[model samples]
Target: MASFHLEEDEIEKGEETMGSEPEVDEDPSSSSATWGPPHQHGRRRVNNYSGGAVGLNINEAPHVNKDSTPFCVFMLYFARIIRLLVEETNRYYHQYLDELQDGPSPRPDMTDSEMFLFLGIIIQMGHDIRDRLKDYWSTAEQFAMPFYSNTMKRDRFLHILRFLHFADNNTETDRNADSYDRLWKIQTIFNTLNDAYEKYYNPSKHLAIDEIIVKFKGRVVFRQYIPKKHKRFGIKIFKICDATGYTYDMKVYLGKDRTRADQDVTATHATVRGLCRCIEGVGHKLYMDYFFSSPDLFEELMTKDITCCGTVRPNRKGLPDDFRRRQFRLKKGDIRVRVRWNFTALVWKDKRDVYILTNMHCPPAEGSFCDEHGNAIKPAIVADYNKHMGYVNKADRMANSYSISRRTWKWTNKLFFHFLDMTILNSFILLSSCDAKLSHREFHLALVRNMLEHAARGPPRPQRSRGRPPAVSSAISRLEEASRHHWPTSSTSRLRCRVLFV
Candidate 1:
């Protein structure tokens, strides 16, 4: 194994010594951190944002206002959102009336306070899931949850949900037009939240682009089926997140992108580019996996003043012929490197072969790093990837743990609830800056409780029916009111009730 490693390095050294390598097509840039040879353009050589840089310099250190509450922080992102929802929801309700001259309009038009009460219930529902939506309204002692029945009538709550709408029924744009949107049903909500996501907070220098799946099994045209993902079947969203696990931007993947067919870039390249637009032309370090990384993509991004590093597939185009070979084996901690115009393509051996490509760190390929308690570890690039690459995944994991998602066959419901969770999660993240010790669950409970409290104080709550209340069980009836219990006077009775004196 050692001989093989030595022979591989020697062969590469001999080529350089003999000057047998082909010269690059472009002149080297005058930049100080220039690697290998000159490139086509004077692109980024290091990751740093010049205060003089004029683009998206949102190198953010986010903080919540010291005087703010969770509701205030949430409203900061969703105030306009809730208002838009109320307007559209009421519009849709009235539209239904005009269409059917509908029988008694499903429980009066939704109001601002009522809509909030509805949202409060939805948020609370995500905290604890039951068998069915109706279960929340159950009046049985074992299944009773007063928050649901007390805030609003079961029928009224379901009425608002049934007519819940975002886009107007009459305002849908033409499908035949080139600007058609596949997700028009929730497009407004998607864009509104997405904008708020970026507008409120800017990420630090380290950003990662990766795919996130919202678990869905409904029959939708754009639903993705990735067997390897925990959500094996769902909608796929490509998000560029900060090192802090905040989603800075996202692109919902619909089938084949017709928009990219006219462009020279691959779908993955375009996805990464679209997600990175806010951070482009700024010397922010991007990280992704091999599926999104390639020599062309890396260099293209470099030209835009962004430097990225990721694990590369040996078979990817522009990788040297030797890297594409999977036949050979190497001892642990062995490495083979090929440098091309600020990009370093590396093959390091550990439990198995690992390939990496980057225009960032150019670590010595002779030996592995021993940064962990004197034990050998992977190289610098691997260490950095491990540190920053899981931010998106962490965000997903956190959201899923207390997701407000409910069972639904409607694609509209799935998309709406999923993004709703995203909004809550992002709001919680912002609030954390103010109270660093707050947990997501605690923040969520506090936020929902605050909303419910407001709803409780708002106009009179829905009253129970005017008839006799539902019958109580014998056990509950006996324990509540003090009553005289006359036992049958029988000597044959073996069981007796006796009060113990304390």
Candidate 2:
């Protein structure tokens, strides 16, 4: 091998003398013992040849100064938004507690206040936080974005308080933070959200129920209860989403105990009933999955004048196959009575062939209404019911197909993160309610495109000086002048482009 070593003095002298010569490529066959070139191979070089003060004597210099600004101003704005929301929520919660208990300030230290506030904000904003980010940050921030919303935040805070035994274990509990416990804080956020749904949205006839699974830190091993199927730990989240996609109610059923009794079915039912009581109407509907279906529970809902719609399992033997076929019959107006549907079937539990059970009865309408594919449809309500059932079946299938490992925190975070992702999807649904012209999925796509465009068109940076820096006022003046010349023309061009695209 050829001797490649060079003295420090020789290298410095070579740099000085060879300054004017074109920079040579790094040697390709350097031994593995040597570090790779400082820069990547086959890359263009940045020439900072402007040696004099305030002027470039040569033609080339680095394209832009790296330190002038953050890579994403959009992300900064989102962080600011998260901060603002947390501060505001804490203010409201503390105020509410103050009125009820006649107490002094809940949390005194500013740092403690901020940390809990962040926890509350993340859970309350659950998934909705991601929506705000979709319009600003790239996919990286989206992945890191917290699962929180106004309701979930409050719920988590309360759950933490309950776990610490700082307050009464009731819906209207007012206990605040006692100490700094991380897991307590996390659990409180979820539990409080569940209570909020019971208090505000559950009783109303307009609420619907869904379940979410939140992964945890370690494997759930149980001696008394049924050990969780996968070693991975998770909390089963029961959410009551209103027609608008906002969570009115929730329950964080710890997944460690898989026994039928420990699942807290009674508490979950009571919470659902509590939510239903909030709505001021004679007839309301509560949508659920097959897991919640029971003879007594269905009868209880019927007695309360609240209708329940969900999948009835195959082995549910009270109603026969012949009865189901007869019940599926359609009728015409005047002669047609609004009979409840008894949707129970033994077909495979997949997206394409899942069954829906409802108490409402109706005559099937075939030709009057058509699906998107122009196929003759059943009654409009029946079609809607079918779509909803299809979505639940699909979600269940997707959840089953995927499994997370328990070996790392990254895996745990990833599972919970995916569960929180529904908040963005739900927000898109809410936006669609405001403007019927767009679907939630379509709105998300548009926002993503806009965000990418903004990121690619990164902000311009200020130039660095060799000697004394320019005065602040002088720099401001230059920026103002640039703006005056640039903004109006840019705005007009953008408008023209939008018009053409439309």
Best lDDT among the predictions, by candidate number:
1
Candidate lDDT values, in order? 0.69, 0.37
Candidate 2, residue 442: how far the Cα is off, in Å = 16
Candidate 1 per-residue C-alpha lDDT over 389-462 given as tens digits, one digit per residue, 9 for 90 to 100: 77787778777777878777777777788777777788777766444567788888888877876666767644
Task: Give the Å shift of residue 405 in candidate 2.
Answer: 16
Q: What would the per-residue lDDT of candidate 2 be over residues 1-502, giving only the tens digit for each residue?
A: 1111211111121100000111234331233212122122222233222212221111222221222121121121133333333443455455456455233324421223333333334333322333432222233653543333321234344433322222222324323334322233234433433343233222323345655545555443211121433323454555665445555445444323223343434444554555455442355566665555443455566555555665544344333343334433321111111211222222211112233345433223222333465443333344444434333323333333322212233322343333334433333333333333554444444444444344335443223234544456665677687776654456688999999999
RMSD after Cα superposition, model 2: 33.2
lDDT of model number 1: 0.69
The regions of model 2 sitting more than 4 angstroms off are 1-187, 196-206, 215-217, 221-234, 255-282, 321-355, 363-381, 387-502
lDDT at position 450, candidate 2: 42
Q: What lDDT would candidate 2 get against the real structure?
A: 0.37
